[model samples]
Target chain A: MEKKKTTIILFSGDYDKAMAAYIIANGAAAYDHEVTIFHTFWGLNALRKDENIEVKKGFMEKMFAKMMPRGADKMGLSKMHFAGMGPKMIKDVMKKHNAVPLPQLIEMAQEQDIKLVACTMTMDLLGLKEVELLDNIEYAGVAAYLADAEDGNVNLFI
Target chain B: MEKKKTTIILFSGDYDKAMAAYIIANGAAAYDHEVTIFHTFWGLNALRKDENIEVKKGFMEKMFAKMMPRGADKMGLSKMHFAGMGPKMIKDVMKKHNAVPLPQLIEMAQEQDIKLVACTMTMDLLGLKEVELLDNIEYAGVAAYLADAEDGNVNLFI
Candidate 1:
């Protein structure tokens, strides 16, 4: 069978959504297909090893955060403060569920020849220097993502 | 404790997403919180009592359609076209799942006093007349969704 190339343009600033992109892109890799994920805006946070992700919280956010054991970790809320139930719950879930960290997932994608692109505009707007970002990301402009998107691959906004 | 209201924007034109929105809104209603689902774009398609959702070909998107069930229906690419394996899988998995249907979920939200807002911009773009939509949908614009989302409440876009 002839191999088909499909690129996915994921646009999202939401932490939970960035996590979703990682999951979906990883799943695509398992299928032995060419997968490219474009991360922009809020998505850039996922590529950082720095603990800077911040999800705004109020009474409900705090209350809701407590009820869920794994909190944002299991719920795919990457930007959640202290991961809902804090680092312990997140570590526990990661071990028990075999959930891969976002960074590790990117590594796996790289091993599988998956192309990872980061939006340059978002980086500039957010004041993210190349030195600040992780090693695996490719910086580009709208034309880069749009070119892939127009190829009829897949354009997704998370 | 004072009760807070949140606007949950459900931007789905797909059958399954509409269904997910209804179920999620229903879940939020269980918390006795006010929920508003703003349906716009392709999401308007689900409100129509007519037409079947399609799940496109390809294993991943189809599997996603089958797994998510509601989000994929809008594509109209049911798995049945493939010797019945796909559709049957979708049905079997759906049986064990407990998500509410789009219509019923909407009713549950309304009965529980959850607000429903439909996007007028999307309606115009899709050439959908107000009469073509479901009865409970309140049509508005981006300004409306933003206005509702402004209250520092839990905001979700599904």
Candidate 2:
């Protein structure tokens, strides 16, 4: 029997949004589906390593790196961002509810062997070096994404 | 041969996000795919009528209605929303490029026979009434969305 395919385009940088993407990806993986999460634009922040990697970059790239969150744990909430308080509040609630944090959710996705692909085009635009991201993830462009999505049972742009 | 299906869960209320959703939906429709855009959460704002409707509502519902944009044209941008200036700049650029605005894209989707569905669960939660939305759209719940999406070639959450 053919396995069902799920492809998600993670395009938002918000912590809550990334959590949603990872949660969905993990769920699909648990269901024995082949899942691919293609991180693009601000979504690339989720894949960034917490420690900065010193690399040569253009002025715009440096500016973007400084402005964007270092990793998933540093990202903010999509709604009620209340001067960075919303993320803290949500994290507390998640802890109380025994909900998995975004970072752990991402780890679980990787453990499940759900393929993670970073958008190479956006990486160049944002000045993110390959060494700056988490290890073991593939890097590709839109053509690769479209090839996966065109036959996917669940193709989501999140 | 069975027609290819595309289903989108329009989850963001941002003007640019909604525009992206509509553009993809329109493109799928043009490609002769059966398409559905299931509006939920903030996505409901795009389906709202610009004119105010005097509907009875609880305090929370009224507050939600008041805070959300009345229609697609009034929604803010997801990125670079510099004190509401980003949307204006985008509109200017879109005008210069002769790009269709979000409202027209919705109209075009209708003309192409694409299905526009409002998530009834979220609509009730948000206290939006039927009269407050555009005519000729269907109201449904998650089951209906999943029914379409489980067989969909492209299922997006935007």
Candidate 3:
């Protein structure tokens, strides 16, 4: 029998939203399902690092990288974001709940061998370079995601 | 023949995200799928009206309703929100793309008889009252949503 397949399109880069996406992906993987998370657009921000890294890119792309949040810890909240404090409050709540932070969640997802594919189109559009992202991830476009989703029993956009 | 079920959990109340959710729900309904949008938490904000209406609620509830955006039109963007102006820019982009606004897309969903259910638990948490929300919608808890999702061919959270 074919293994149960779950394909998720993680489209939000907000800290809380990214947490939800990773939580679902980890849950599916725990159920013995083949899971794929296609990160696109702002979702790519979750993969960025806080420290500046040299990557050959145009002026605009480099500027985009500088402007956006470096990683999950630096991301803003989707709502109640009173400046940057909303994310801090939510992080405090998460710690209280014993929920792992977004970075840790991403590490767990990788440990589970869930396929994390960065959308190349978004990378080009946002001017994100591979050196800025964490290791152990694949790169693909919408066509690749569609091909995987077409065969999957479950498909989600988040 | 039974229609395929598509149940979406509208967890984010961001204007663009709500637009995406409604667009998907409308698309699924057009394809003859039984579509249900279970609005919960911040998602409930999309169903609110812009005008203030007197509703019988506790002090905390009323305060919540007052602080949050009344309707879909008043919602801010999930990201890049420059003091609430980011939504305006996105609306401009949507207009250029000839995409309908969130309110119109919602009307379209209702016209198609797509099931729009509000999460009671979230209502209690957020202090939203039915009087402040758009009419002709169902109210239910997670049990009801779970029942719908159990048979759903596609389930999404956004």
Best by lDDT: 2
As a whole number from 0 to 100, the lDDT of residue B32 in candidate 3 is: 99
Going through the candidates in order, state the TM-score of chain A alone for each one.
0.68, 0.98, 0.95
* TM-score of every model versus the real structure: 0.43, 0.63, 0.66
Displacement of the residue A154 alpha carbon in candidate 1, Å: 26
lDDT of 1 at B135: 68
Cα-lDDT of candidate 1: 0.55
Q: After superposition, how far is residue B77 of candidate 3 from its true place, in Å?
A: 8.7
lDDT by residue (tens digit), candidate 3, B57-136: 76556556766888999987868988877988988998999989999999999999999999875575556778889999
lDDT of 1 by residue, B20-43 (tens): 667767877788766788765445
Model 3: residues with Cα > 4 Å off, grouped in runs: B1-3, B14-36, B44-66, B69-151, B154-158
Query: Once all C-alphas are superposed, what RMSD does model 3 give against the true structure?
Result: 6.1
Q: Give Cα-based local distance difference scores for all models.
A: 0.55, 0.88, 0.83
Residue B125, candidate 1: how far off, in angstroms?
0.7
Check candidate 3 and list the clashing pairs: none
Residue range A1-158, candidate 3, lDDT tens digits: 67777788988888767876776678678777788999999999888877888888889987888788998788886777776656775566456446678899999999999999999999989999898988888999989999998887667787
* CA-based DockQ, model 1: 0.03
Question: In candidate 1, which residue ranges exceed 4 Å CA deviation?
Answer: A1-157, B51-88, B96-99
